[model samples]
Target: MPTARAIDTSDRHPIRAFLDLRWGGPTIMLDGRAIDAAALPGFVALDADGAIAGLITLLDDALQSEIVTLDAVQAQAGLGTHLLELAAERARALGLGRLLTRTTNDNLDALRFYQLRGFRLHRLAAGAIDLEREADPAIPLLGRHGIPLHDEISLIRVLGAD
Candidate 1:
C-alpha cells in the first residue's frame, strides 16, 4: 500500500492535471455548479515508485468539512482506506468537528464503503442528479448495478467526540 499525506497548494498543478483529466476539467459538477477541485485541500497516496495511486479532496468550513472527491487508481489493496484515514486525521487536526460527503444513489459501493468507515446516511435528495446533469451534461444516465443515476445521498461522520 502507498503512504498518504497532505498536499498543499504548491502541489496543485500536478494534482490538477490528474483530477481534471479524470473528470474532463479542473471542476467537479455538483448540485449544478463547478467546484474548482484544485483549490481545495487534498491528500495523495504514492506508490513505492513515487507514482500517485490515490487522492482525496476536501473543502472545510469553520465547523466542518466536505469530502469533495476520493479516488484510488488501484483497487482492493487498501489505497482508498489510507486516503480516507488521512482525510479524517487532517479533519480532526483542524478541529473541523465533522466530515461529510455526497454520492449518487446508484453508488452502492461508495455507500457501503463510507458506512463501514463510520459515516452515516444523513440526507436524501431525490432526483437531484437530473438537475445536476442539466448543468453538466456529461453525467451518465445510468450508474453502478444498472441503477438510474438520479438521486443524491449525503453521508456524514462526526469527529472529536472520544
Candidate 2:
C-alpha cells in the first residue's frame, strides 16, 4: 500500500505536472468557477517507488472543507480511500463541520464511492455542467459510460462531534 502525506510547497512542481496530465492543467471548474487545484492544501499518496499514486486537494472555508479533486492512479487499490481519510482528519483538526465534494451526473463511480464512504446527497444542480461548458468549451458533452454530462451532484459527509 502507498503512504499518504501532506502536500507542502516543495511538492508544487510534481503536483502541477500530475494535475496537468490528469486534469488538463491545474485549474478545475468548481461551483461555476475556475480554481487552481495545485495551490490547494491536501494529501498525496506515494508508492514504494516514490512516485505519486494518488492525490486529493482541499478547499476549506469557515464552515466546511471541500474536496476540490481526488484521483487514484490505480483503481480499487484503496488509494482514494486513504487520501480521503487523511483529508477528513485534517478537516476535523481544523474544526470544520463537514467535507463536501461535487461530481458530474455522468460520473457514476464517484457517486457510488462518496456515498459508500458516508457522504450523502446534498443537492442536484441541474444543468450546472452545461453552464460550465459555456465558459470552457473543452468540457466534454459525454462522460463515463457515455452518459450525457449535464448536472452537478453535490455530496457532503458531516463530521462527527469532536
Candidate 3:
C-alpha cells in the first residue's frame, strides 16, 4: 500500500480532477473555481498502484481546524480511519486543539461514522438547508436517504494537542 503524503500543489491537478467527480455540483465547488494556492493544507493517500484512494483538506481556524473535505473510495477498508488519524495528527502538530466537521442531516452514514470515530454530537443548524438552498438553489433539498435536508449537523473531536 502507498503511504499518505502531503499533497503537492504543483502536481495537484489529478487530485482536483478526482474530487470534482464527487463534488462538482452535487456537493461543493471543490474544483469549479481556481485555487488560490495560498489556501490551507491538503493531503492524499495513494494505493499500491499510485492512485489516490483518499483525499482530505484542512481549513485552519483560530479555535479549531475544520475538516473541509474527506473522501475515500474504499469504505470499510480503513481508508477513512487512516485519513482521520492523519487529520488528528496534523491538527496536533499545527497547535490546533480540536477538529470540527459539518454534514447535512440527511447524511446518516456520515453521522454514524463520525460518532463511531469519537466525534461528539455538538449542535444542529436548524436553517442550514434553507441557507444552503438560498446560496445555491441547485442544491437538492432532499438527501440520499429521502430525508428532507433542512439543517446541518455539527460534530467535534478534541485533538490531544494542547
Best candidate, lDDT-wise? Answer: 2
User: For candidate 2, which ten residues in a row score worst on lDDT?
Assistant: 27-36
**Model 1 worst lDDT run, 10 consecutive residues:** 23-32
Q: What ranges in model 3 sit over 4 Å off?
A: 25-39
Candidate 1 stretches with Cα past 4 Å from truth are: none
| Candidate 2 positional error at 43, Å | 0.4
Candidate 2 residue pairs that clash: none
How would you order the candidates by TM-score, starting with the best? 2, 1, 3
In candidate 3 the C-alpha lDDT for residue 35 amounts to: 34
Per-residue alpha-carbon lDDT of candidate 3 for residues 1-162, written as tens digits (9 for 90 to 100)? 347887777546766666667667213422133333224476788888878788777777787877778888788888887888888888888888888987888899999999899899888888767876776798887887799988878899987732
Error of 3 at 24 (Å): 1.5
lDDT of 1 by residue, 96-157 (tens): 88988899999998999999989999999998999888776888999889998999999999
- List pairs with backbone clashes in candidate 1: none
Q: Name the candidate, 1 or 2, with the larger lDDT value.
A: 2
- C-alpha lDDT of residue 116 in model 3: 94
RMSD of 2: 1.1
Whole-model lDDT, candidate 2? 0.93
- Determine the C-alpha RMSD for candidate 3 after optimal superposition of all C-alphas: 3.6
**Model 3 worst lDDT window (10 residues):** 29-38
